[model samples]
Target: AQSVTQLDSQVPVFEEAPVELRCNYSSSVSVYLFWYVQYPNQGLQLLLKYLSGSTLVKGINGFEAEFNKSQTSFHLRKPSVHISDTAEYFCAVSPTARQLTFGSGTQLTVLP
Candidate 1:
């Protein structure tokens, strides 16, 4: 069985500061990782994904994630934070031929 874990429940960063939202996963089979962001009262939008080929995957809204097989981690990062970036981030994993498994979300608060 595969499971996703979000270690941080909430993260606060100042504008222009760098931030990383940690995500870890465990699975017996190969897993495709994804990062989704949900703004206030909005649906979950796909940020980035690591399906194959490159370990470093770039996504929309200046977000990126690296898939580390050995560590079973897919962590999301942004070099600089913005006020509009405040949202809840969710890490999900889909194993080969299986449905998506989601982790508890991380709330990102960008302070002025």
Candidate 2:
């Protein structure tokens, strides 16, 4: 089984500012990492994933994440954020891509 930890539960950022949502994971076996965002009254949307190959993975809405094996981290980052980017961000890990263990979730509030 794998587990994820989101460093921040709530993150408030001004519009157009760079932001980083920290995520770390622990697993006995190899795992795939993912970042999902949920808007108000919406389902979880895949933001980015780190399955293999590249250490730096980019996703929709100008979001990206780097997989650090040494640190056991896959932190999500956005150079500039918009008001629409305000949502709940979740970090998930799957050992077999079948079952996922999700973090508590990080509320990204983009302020004006």
Candidate 2 C-alpha RMSD relative to the actual structure: 0.7
- Name the lDDT value of residue 5 in candidate 2: 95
Return the TM-score for each candidate structure. Answer: 0.97, 0.98
Task: Please identify model 1 stretches exceeding 4 Å from their true place.
Answer: none
How far out, in Å, is residue 47 in model 2? 0.8
Highest-scoring model, TM-score = 2
Clashing pairs in 2: none
| lDDT tens digits by residue: candidate 2, 5-40 | 999999999999999999999999999999999999
Candidate 1 lDDT over 1-52, as tens digits, reads 8999999999999999999999999999888899999999999999999989
On lDDT, the candidate that comes out on top is 2
